[model samples]
Target chain A: MVRHFMAALQKHKMCYALILPTFFLVFLFRYYPAFSGVYHSFFEWDGALLEEWVGFSNYIEAFQDAKLWRSFLVVIVFISANIVKMIPAIIVALLIFHLKSEKHQYLYRVLFVVPMIIPQIVYMLLWKFFYEPNIGLLNQLLIGLGIVEPDLPPMWLADPEWVIPSLIFMGFPWVGVVSVLIFLAGLQSIPNSVYEAADLDGCGILKRCVTIEVPLIMSQIRLSLVLMIIATLKGFERILIMCNEFGGPNGAANVPGLYMFRMAFMEGRVGYACALGMLLFGVILVLTLLNDKYVRVEK
Target chain B: MSAAPKWKNVQQELAKHAGILFVLFFAFFPLYIMLQASLKDNAQFGNNIWLPMAPYHWANWLTGWLAIKDFIANTVIVCVFGVLLTLAFSITTAYVFARYKFPGSNVLFYMLLAVMMMVNVASLVPLFTLLRDLGMLNSLISLILLSIANGQVMCVYVMKNFIEDIPKDLFDATSIDGATDLQVVRSVVIPMSGSIISTLAILRFIATWNDFVMPMLIMRDEQMYTLGVGLMSLNSGYDTQWGPLMAAYCIASIPLVIIFIFTMRLFVKGLSSGAVKG
Candidate 1:
C-alpha cells in the first residue's frame, strides 16, 4: 500500500503542485491559528508579549470565573431563543409551499429574499437604531399608543433587565430567507404521490402538514438546528455591535463569545481568551455530536 | 360538495396568504422604515414616526454618500480581488481533486472538510496575532488574504461536486489533444462550470463584503475601514443623525441589492442546492 501510494504521488506530481497554494493558505491561516489557539491557551501570553507557561491555570481560572458562567447562561438562553426563532422560517416556508398559485409562490419567495440583500451589519444597525431610547421607533410607537409615558420610555439596550430580551427581539419575526429557502427545498422535494395519498385519506391541510410535510423535512430541520446552534455559539459580533464590548449593563447580555473577545482584545488576556475559546469549542463539539447521534431523520 | 370544498380551499389559501403577509410585514418593516426615514429630517422623523413625510431630505443621501463612499470603494476592492483569487485557487484545487487519483487525496480533501466544523470565534485571537506578526494589520491585503483563505473551503466543496458532475469525455478529449492541465481547466472546466462559479463568487462576495469583525480587529485607521466597521463608526457618533444614517444604511445595501436584482434566480438556486447538499 505504501509503495503504491508513493508511485501514485510520483506519477501525479502535478496534482500536488496544483493543490499546494490552497493547502499552504489553509494551513497558514486556518489550521495554524486553530492549533495556536490551543497552544496559547496553556500560556500567560498578553497578546503582544509576556508569554509564560501557565499549565492549565487559564482553564482553571475559567472554571471558576463568574462572568464566564454568566455568559454561558446567557448563551443557553440565546440558543433556546434561536431554536424558537427558527420556527417562523419553517412556518413561512410551509405556507409558501402550500400556496395554491405557482406565480404567487415564486413572488413570495422573491419578496422573502429581498430583505436578505441588506448586509447583516446594516440590519443589526437598524435594530440598534430601533432600540435607541430617545426618539427611537419602538419607544415612539409605545408613546404614541399611550402604553408608556414619553418621559419614562424603556431603555431597551441600556437596562439590564431588558437587554437580553431586546437582543433576542432585534431580528423580529426571524423568518430568515436562507432558512425559508432550505425548508422550501425540502418541502418541494416531497413526492406528489404522498400528497395524493394524504388527500385520499381525507387529511386536512394542517393534519397533512403535521403528518406528512414536516416529517419528510426532518433532515432539513435537523441540519438547520445544528447550524443555528453553531452560529449562536460562535456569534459575538452581533452583541459586540449592539451592546458594546461589556455586553450591555452589568454584562447582562454577555455570551461566551463576546466575553472571549473582551478578554482577548480589550483586556489583552489572550491566553485566557484562548482557554475560553477551547471551552466553547468543546461545548459546540459535544452538542454537535449529540445532535448527530440523537436527531435521526426518518426517510 | 365540489363548491363547498372549493370555497374551503379559497379560505385556506386566503389564510395562508394572510399568514405569509403577516410575517412579511414584520420582516419588511425595518427596511420600509429605513427607506422612509432616510427621506426625513430629524424634526420630520419626530413628527411622522411611521410614515414617509414629503419634502424629502434628499441631501441626507449626499451626506451618507460622502461618509461611506470610501468604505464602499474599499469593500469593493477587497471583494473583487478576494473573490477572483479565491475562485482561481479553489477551481485549481477542486479540479485536481475531482479529476485526479493522487495519493492522500482523501486525507487532503477531508482536511479542508474538517475546517467547516472549526468555529472561527475560537481562532480570533490567534488569527489576529498571526496577522499582527506578519505586519499585515491595517492593510487591505490582509482582508483579501483572509477572505481567500476562508472562502476557499465552501467554494472548493461546491465546485468539486460541480466539476465531478461534468462529463469525463470533455476532460479526456482536451488532454488527448495535447492540452496542458491549465489549458484544460481554462477550456473545459471554466466553460462548463460558469453558473456554479458565479454562484460561488456571489456567495463569497457577499461574505467578504459583509465581514466586519476581522476588518475591525486588523484595521486601526479609519481610512482602512470596510463598510461594516465604517457604518458602525458613522452611527456611533455622539449626535445621531437619523436621516443621514438611514441613507447611509441604504447606501451600504445598494451594491448587494443590485447584485441580487440581476442574479436573483441564480442566488436562489445556489442556496437551495447548497441546502440540499451541504
Candidate 2:
C-alpha cells in the first residue's frame, strides 16, 4: 500500500506543482483576510497597533447606533429598487424574445448588452455629471419640456431627500443588459411545446406572459433576485463615487459597505470596521441561504 | 373579422417595435451623452447639451489622451499580466481538481467555492491591511495579485466544469501512449478548451481593466493609477472641465467597446455561464 501510494504521488507530481501557487495565493489573500476579519473584529486598534481586546463592544455599539441601522435601511431601499427594476427587465426580455425574426432579436440583443462593456464607474460618473443641478442633461430636458423652472430645478444628488431617489434613478429604465440576457436565456429554455399548448388554449400575449412565462422562468427570476441582493449589499462603488463625499448629504445614502470602508480607511477605526464587515458578511450569508432554500422549495 | 384581426396585428407589431425602440434609447442615452459632451467645444457647452453638432472639439481627445496615457498603460499591463497569471494558475488547479483523486482535493475545492461567497466588500478591510503590511501598497502588482486571487474561485470553478465535460477516454488514450499527465493536458485538454479559454480570457481582461474599487484602494500613487482611478482624479481635479473629462471617459472606454463589438457572442456566453454557476 505504501509503494502504491508513492507511485500515485509520483504520477501526479506535476498536478501538485501546478496548483501550489494557486493554493498559496488564495490562502494568503482570500482565506487569511476572511478569517483575520473575524479575529480583528474583537480587538480595539489604533492604526496598526492593537490597543486592547474588546469583546462584543463593537457589535454592541453597532446595534445601538441608529446610523448603522439607518444604513441598513438605505441598503434595503436600494435592494427594493433593484427588485422593482426586474419587472421591466423581464418584460423587455420577453418582448425581444418574441421579435418577428431572428435577425431582429440578434440585433437588439447586441445593442442592449453592448453597453454593459462600459465600465460601471464610468456609468456612475456620467450620471453624476447629469445630476449636476445646472447643466445636467436631466435638468436641461426638464427645462426644455417646461416641466420645471430653470432657476429652481431640483438638486438631484445634492439634496438629502433626492439623493437616494436620484441614485436609484441614475440607471433609469434599468433593465440591465445582464438581467435581460439571463431572462432571455430563461425564456428561450422553456420548451416550445408549452408555448404551443398555451396557444392552443387561446392564450393572449399578456395571459401567456403572466400565467405561462412567469411560472416557467421562476429559476431565472430567483437567480436575478439573489444576484441583485448580493450586488446591492456589497456594491458601494457607485455610492462611493456618486456621493464622492461623506455618504451623500449627511448619511442619507450610506450603506454598510461604504460605512465600513470609511471607518477602516478614513477614520482608521480598523476594529469597528472589521465588526461592520462581519455584520455585512453575516447578512449576505443568511440572505443567500434563505434565497436558496426559498427557491428550492418553490421548485 | 379579418379586418379587425389585421388591425390588431398591426397594433401589436407597432407596440413591439416601439418597446424595442424605447429600450434602445435608454440603453444608448448615457453613452450618447458621454459622446456628445466629449465632442462639445467651450462655446457649445451651455448652448445645447443634446447633440455635438458641427465645429466639434476633436482636439479634446488629444488633450485627454495626453493627460492619462500612462494610466492607460498601467491598466493594460495589469490586465495583461493579471489575466495570463490567473489563467495559468486556475487552469492547472482546475484540471487537477477535475481529474486527479488527490487527498483533500474535495475539501480544498469546496474551500475555494466557499470563498466565492465571501468575495465582497467584507474582505476589503482585511485585504487592505494585508497589502499594507506586505509593503505592496501603491503597486500595480498588488492589484494584479489581489484580482487573480479573488477571481480564481470563479475561474477554477468554470474551468473545472469545462474540463470534466471532456471525455475520459481522450486522457486515458494519451496516457497509454506513454504520455505524461502534463503532456496529455497540453496535447488533449488545452486544444479542446479553446472556446472556454477565450471566454475566460476576455471576461478576466475586461473585468481587470474596468475594476474601480480594487485599483482605487490598492494604488495610492497617481502614477500607478488605472484608467478608472485616473478618471476619478480627473473628475475631481478640475472644478468642471466636462469637455476634457468626458473626452477621457470616451477614450478610456474605446478599447472595451471595440472588444465587445467584436466578441459580443462569446462575451454574453461567458457572462451567462459565470452568472449561472456562480
Candidate 3:
C-alpha cells in the first residue's frame, strides 16, 4: 500500500506542480491577510501589535459606535434609492425588448452603458461640480427652465436635508444602465409566445405588461435589487471624493464602506475597522443569499 | 386593443421614444458636461455650468488634460505588466483548480472567493502599514503584485469554469501521445480557450488601467503614478482646475475608445456570452 501511494504521488507530481503557484499567490494575499485581519481585530493593532488579547472588545466597541450606525442608515437610504430607480430600468428594458429591430436595441444598449465605462471618481466629480450650490448645472438649469425662481434655487449636497436626494440623483444616472442591460437580457430569455398569446387575448398593452412582462422579469429584478443593494452599501470612492470625509455636509452621504475606511485607515482603530468590515461583509452576504433564494432560475 | 388604429399606435410609439430619449439625455449628460467643462477656462468653468461661449475645441482639449503626456507612459507600464502577470498566474491557477484533485484545494479556493467579497477598501488600513514596513510604499511592483493577487479570484473562477467544459479526451489524448501535463496545457487547453482568455484579458486591462484606490495608496511618488491616480492629482494642488481635469479625463478615455473601436463586438460578446455561460 505504501509503494502504491508513493507511485500515485509520482504519477500526479505534475498536478501538484499546477497548484503550487496558486497556493503561493493565495497564501501571500488572501489567506494570510484574512487571518492577519482577524488576528489584528482581537488586539489594539497599531503599527505595533502589543499582541494584547482583549476578547470581544472590538465587537462591543463597533456595535456601540454611533458613526457605524450612521453609516448603516446612510447605506440603507442609498439602497432604497436604488430600489426606486429600478422601475424605470425595467420599463426601459421592456421598451427595448418590444423594439422594431435589433439595431435600435444595440444602439440603446451602447448609449446607456456608456456611463459604466467612465471612471467612478470622474463621474462623481462631475456630479460634484453639478452639486456645487449657486453655479451648479442643476440649479442653473432649474432656473433657466423656469422651474424655480432665480433666487429660490435649492442648495443640494451642501445642505444636510438635501444631500441624500442629491446623491440619489447623481447615482441614479449611473446605475439604471446596468439594471436595463440585465433586464434586457432577461427579456430575451422569455419566449415570444407569451406575448403572442397575450396579444391574441385582445389584452391592452398595460395588461400584457403587468401579466406577461413583470412576472418574466422577476429574476432580473431580484438580481438587480441585490446588486444595487451591494453597490449602494459598497459606496465609497465616489462619495469619498465628492463629499470629502465627515460624509460631507453633516454625514448624509456616509455609508458603511466609506465610514469603515475612515474609521480604520484614517483614525487608526484597526480592530474596530475589522469588526465594521465584517459587518459590511455580512450585509452583502445576507443580501446575496436572500437574492439567490428568492430569484431561483425560472424555466 | 387589437382594434386600435395605426395613428394611435404611432402617437404612443412617439411617447415611448420620447421617454427613452429623455433617459438617454440623462445617461449622456454627465459625459457631455465633462467634455464641455474641459474646454472652458478655470474661471469660466466655475462661473458656468454648460459649454463655453467660444468653441476653444483645441484649447479645451489642450490646456489642462493634455499636459499629462508623461503619465501615459507610467500607466501603460503598470497596465501592461499587470495584465500579463494576471494572465500568467490566473491561467495556471485556474487550470490547476479545475483539473487537479489536490489536498485542500477546495478549502483554499473557497478562501480566495471569500476575499473577493472584501473590496480593496477593507484592506486599506493594514495594507498601507504593511507596505510601508516592507519599504514597497511607492513602487510600481506593489501595484502589479497587489492587482495580480487581488485579481486572481475572479479570473481563476471564470477560467476554471471555462476550462471545465473542454472535452476530457483532448487532455487524455495529449498525455497518451507522450505529452507532459504542462505540454498538454500549453498545446491543448489554452489554445481551445481563446475566447475566454481574450475576454479575461480585456476585462483585466480595463480594470487595472482605471483602478484608483490601490494605485493612489501605493504610488505616492509623483514620477510613478498610474493614469487613474495621476488624473486625480492633476486637480489637487491647483484648486480643482476643471479644464485640465476635464482635458485629462477625455484624453485618458481615448485609448480605450480606440481599442474598443477595433474589438467592440468581441468586447460586447465577451461580457454577454460569459454572463450567459455563468
Each candidate: RMSD to true structure? 1.7, 2.2, 3.2
* Candidate 1 per-residue lDDT over residues B1-278, each given as its tens digit: 69997998899999999999999999999999999999899899888878988999899999999999999999999999999999999999999999987668999999999998788989999999999999999999999999999988988998898889999899889988999888988999999977678878887888898898999999999998999999999888987788998999998999998988898887777776642244
> Per-candidate interface C-alpha RMSD?
1.3, 1.9, 2.7
* lDDT pick, better of 2 and 3: 2
Residues B1-278 of candidate 2 have per-residue lDDT tens digits of 69998898888878997998897788789999888888787668888888777788888898889988999999988988999999888988888898988766788889888887784677777888888899998998888897788679888998898899999999888888998666767898789987687778877887898798878887878899999899888888656677777898888888888877777776667655533345
TM-scores for chain B, listed for all candidates: 0.95, 0.91, 0.83
Best by DockQ: 1
- lDDT-best of 1 and 3: 1
Clash pairs for candidate 1: none
Give the alpha carbon lDDT tens digit for every residue of A1-299 in model 3: 98987787787777667766666766676666666666677777654554567788888888898878888988787778678778888888778777776887777777675666676556666777687777778888888889978876788887889888888877544445556777777888879798788879999988888988898878778767765677677768777777766787778778888887777767777777766776677777787777668766554
Give the DockQ (2 decimals) of all models: 0.78, 0.65, 0.46
**Lowest lDDT 10-mer window, candidate 3 chain A?**
A171-180
TM-scores for every predicted model: 0.97, 0.95, 0.89
Largest lDDT belongs to which candidate?
Answer: 1
Please provide, for model 1 over A1-299, each residue's C-alpha lDDT reduced to its tens digit, 9 standing for 90 to 100. Answer: 98987888789999999999899999999999999999999999898869999999999999999999999999989999999999899999999998989999988999998888789999999899888898788998888889998888999999999999999988999988888998999999999999889989999878988889988998889888888888899889999999899999999999999999999999989999999999999999898789868885555
